[model samples]
Target chain A: MNISDFQTRFGFEAMYDGYVDAEVLGGYTSDLLSDVMSKAGEASTLVTIQAHKNTVAVATLVGINSIIICNSRPVSAEMIESAKAEGIALFRTDKTQFEVSGLLYCALRDAKA
Target chain B: MDIPINTEGGSRVILELIYSLKVRDVMTRKLVTASADTGMREVQQLMRDNGITGIPIVERTRLLGIVSIGDLLKALDQGQMAEPAASHMSASVVTLEEEMPLTFAISYLNRYEFRRFPVLDKTGSLAGIITASDIIKTLLVEMNREVERLEATIAHPQTIDPAASPGLDPGSAGTPEEIVLSLSFPTRQYDFDGAGKASAEFKKALKQLGIEASIVRRAAIASYELELNQVIHSTGGVMEYILRGGRITIVARDQGPGIADVQAALTEGFSTANNWIRSLGFGAGLGLPNAKRSGDDFSIDSAPGRGTTVCVTLNYAAGP
Candidate 1:
């Protein structure tokens, strides 16, 4: 599904501008940068409470189609610059990482599984 | 590069070379010495023959004083050429440790008008001497190599980073087929603000290079895990990435207080992550296990006080 679909289904703010329509094949969630780096699969939508600039870089590096900054964390200006530079689809939500990850998992379960 | 004076960390290469350089690396180890009782005429002849300005006056292994050309001139003018070297030598001295870093020596040189620094060994005996000219000579050689490297980089613009090719075989690749990406990022413990920046930039660059999305994801995820692991478990560390032909390998090396057990740490849930870390959603012991699982091959070599090095290799050619 497109990030717009995910945004529409859950009230999430699209935070950065980059031409990204990457397909979401799966989803992974973690607040620890290490865990997410190791476990997050390809084309996955990464949902996490990490809203720092490094988050955008990780999302771009891991090929995460979209980044969901959970817990309403503030996305800094540096993060937005990296998001735009990396062509990553950026989003933010008031939900927890667990809740957002669950939603994305459920959304892709039938299609990916 | 001309680094802005206000910039933090300064120019990386300048700082790296300056700090990495040691006094032992540049100090003149072949020292010429004289006994305090040596005849003034003999010492003057030794200095004239060697073209040296001064000779350190010694008593066995202990440094007593220094006799310079001026001391010799004074002795000759006063008709004291028959006197011992100590009679005209300056007794006070400033010295530098043989093991001192070049930076400290540089600071000492700047703070004093001393023509040279007497280097002492661990036994407090004179080992060598360093002059300002020695440092300039060392810097000239270093700066020349840098210039050559920059020229080579300018000669070929397609390589990722010219400095990145330090370890590459001169004949490794003449074409783009074997073109690889080599980079390293330093990470600090408890530096949450900078935690994932390295992997993120790595991921973006890989994607731009046209690596398949799935492959980039796996490699990036693994990179992130290693970076975070350094921040959480070790002292300060660096995440090294080498993207070679179809394979991505990351080596996580750190300064330690290293791991006592590699096996126990790899267990699915046996984490040393403190309670505070747990609340932040890490230290679950899943970081290493997950990193290993993501790699086509993974191995960790670690020892106490020696630090840890975790190598993760992901072959993009292999199915994800």
Candidate 2:
């Protein structure tokens, strides 16, 4: 998906000055800890609502491009800076984890279709 | 008439020249360090507070093993009720000597999948520690610094647009025509593993120079897309940067199953990637378009079964 589509669908404004020119290669949405571990890489953008430092570390290890910190719980300042220094874009949504995952599923399904 | 093959642009010449680019030149010379005896609680807290996943366990310039947030997580799994750090920390250290070049550092770091490596002094003590993040910082600085100097020259008419009219600061404002900033990386056939290293390193060079945020993002996104293409499609390829006037140009060429339709391939949603590639989070067909959009000028040359080459030039106007 294009950056504009993401902005409209997710209702998010760029946190930094210049907007992120990201391409959705595909979408991976899951809360299952192990599931994420077995999949995901530095290239793939991850969608999750789990608000914990562990999530950041996991994303870093697998080299995820971006982490959609879902649930609108307000991303931690530390996580934000970590993502910045690492050049991994972090996106947060007011939508619950389940709702966001559903959206992601639909998005991916449409793309594949 | 015979077309003369010259060494002016030979691959061997390029590789030999780039091989000399050292790690300390690209590695974060001033890395964050910590004492080996740091407590587990403090270490974990530090990692969280600093937004860093790893820290170099050092002692007055002595290198010890490194600890990552993952290590701490494993420790937590074992037991998290106020345990001693000695129980959790791994002393099997991987290190790089301060004199060691950045090229060697990149190889070792990529092989070990290490986020940070402690730099040893002449005595094998921790002189400092470098992390993957440090590399990112350095690359970004290179791009940022270049843009700023360009912008500065624009702002001050007499300053001589650094790239076009230099002789002001060779180290910073040197003539762009003479400044050749290049980056190299290992490539494999459809090997998704460690593919982002080149782009990451390229971005680090930009970031380290303290380049403007806008230019950094431009070069980073463009470089990243090119790097991903190399890993996903090409047998291997290299990314090179050249500066002239106020334009910074990037060239990405790779040997692989070349595209049959360059224009169609440039579309937003035309992908020929497989399921495995898709699962890894790429192959959606946005790489080409994304690269095009990120830069002011873009071009692509390819053949059905030969290879593909992409070139992008970003023009920065002098800041008034």
Candidate 3:
């Protein structure tokens, strides 16, 4: 399923309130930039809370589908602005990291089914 | 809670505090090396004797390439096993420098689907070689060290200032889960041959941040599936993550046609994916469901004309 389908099915509120017309890739969750760089392949979705620009550089290098900040944490304005500038779909979640990952896994499974 | 302690600690005491650690701290410095001219029979014997799967093929200490058991066997397929090692060895060797941080090394190994790699010097000389087994050993050693340090700390909890502790320092033997970190990235759809790049990036990030192997694998699989989903289902999308408080979460969003039926899509055998998707070794209808099974929690929201969003969470439970 696509990002819009995820929002509607899981009742996720858009972080930026803007229309993002991207397709759903896959998910990655790790804080290690080297690992992300070498492993997170191109055009795949990533799930990470590391908001550094280095993250953006790696994402740009590997070319992810979007980014999701979990753990009920808030994305810095600078990060959000940068994401927009880079044309990345930035999001935030009130759910705990566990909750967000679990929900996404289920949805992806549901879609696969 | 103060107590007297000795320099040496008990194993149980150490193991209790060192569980769930990573392999970045104790990677072997003694990297094995070999020559490209080495015969396949000799290489096979060396591997069997040393219990190794790979070796860096060097020329006058310069890293020319590498040879693995698989490479040797592949040569055998063409009746070339009797030939020189250079003729059968992999030409484009993936390598790492000795000075590179362990995180980078781990990421390189995990991301490339390679079981072993050569380490090179500035002059292109072979320094050593690292393998998946070596990394695993490193992790084990680090865990042991952490356990020892933790036992010492616990034995004299009052003498050490908790506030002054270097949280999650691998060299200092701190707990693995003590680190607080965050990461982000963008997804692009440049071409078909370039697909799976985003997920690869995400895996690299995790390796750099020092996540465990199992965790990285789960994340990689999920990301790869989503990337293939993008190539098969839509024009493109993005995937991102966050790591904190003993859990990692993954999110994928895209501007593609939404799923028609959430229930039908969630099933195992059903697939709207085309034959092209299957041709690429995906679209077996296992991507989404496999991701859900691998994660602690999974959720998705999509509309018929709107885009799609996916979220996945991985919880590294405390006190495991």
Residue B32 local lDDT, model 1? 82
TM-scores, each model vs. reference? 0.51, 0.40, 0.36
- Arranged by TM-score with the best first, the candidates are 1, 2, 3
Candidate number achieving the greatest TM-score relative to the actual structure: 1
Number of the top DockQ candidate: 1
RMSD in Å for model 2 = 18.3
lDDT of 3 by residue, B1-320 (tens): 11112112345333222222222233455656667677777777777888778766767777777788888788778777667778777889777655444444555665587776676554555666666666666656766787788798789886666633323223634545444444444343322334555666677777776777677767766666666565457545666666667777777777767888977777765677543233333455666776677688899898778877787888764334
Weakest 10 consecutive residues of candidate 1 chain B by summed lDDT = B1-10
Deviation in Å, model 2, residue B170 alpha carbon: 22
After superposition, which runs of candidate 3 have C-alpha atoms over 4 Å from their true positions?
Answer: A1-113, B1-34, B159-320
Better of 1 and 2 by TM-score: 1
What lDDT would each prediction earn against the true structure? Answer: 0.75, 0.62, 0.61
lDDT of 2 by residue, A1-113 (tens): 64444567777544443435566666567553224534554356677765544355445444556677666766766567656766666777777667766776687678779
Off by over 4 Å in 1: A6-9, A16-26, A29-35, A95-113, B1-181, B201-213, B243-248, B275-281, B315-320
Worst 10 residues of 3 chain B by lDDT: B1-10
Expressed as tens digits, the lDDT of each residue in B1-320 for candidate 1 is: 11122112456555546555667788898778899899999999888888788898988778888888888999999999999998899888888776555665776777676777788876688888888888888978987887798798889877477644333345655656654687778876655556777877787777777877777777777777788888777766788777777788788888787889889988988888754455556677888888888789999999999988889998766324
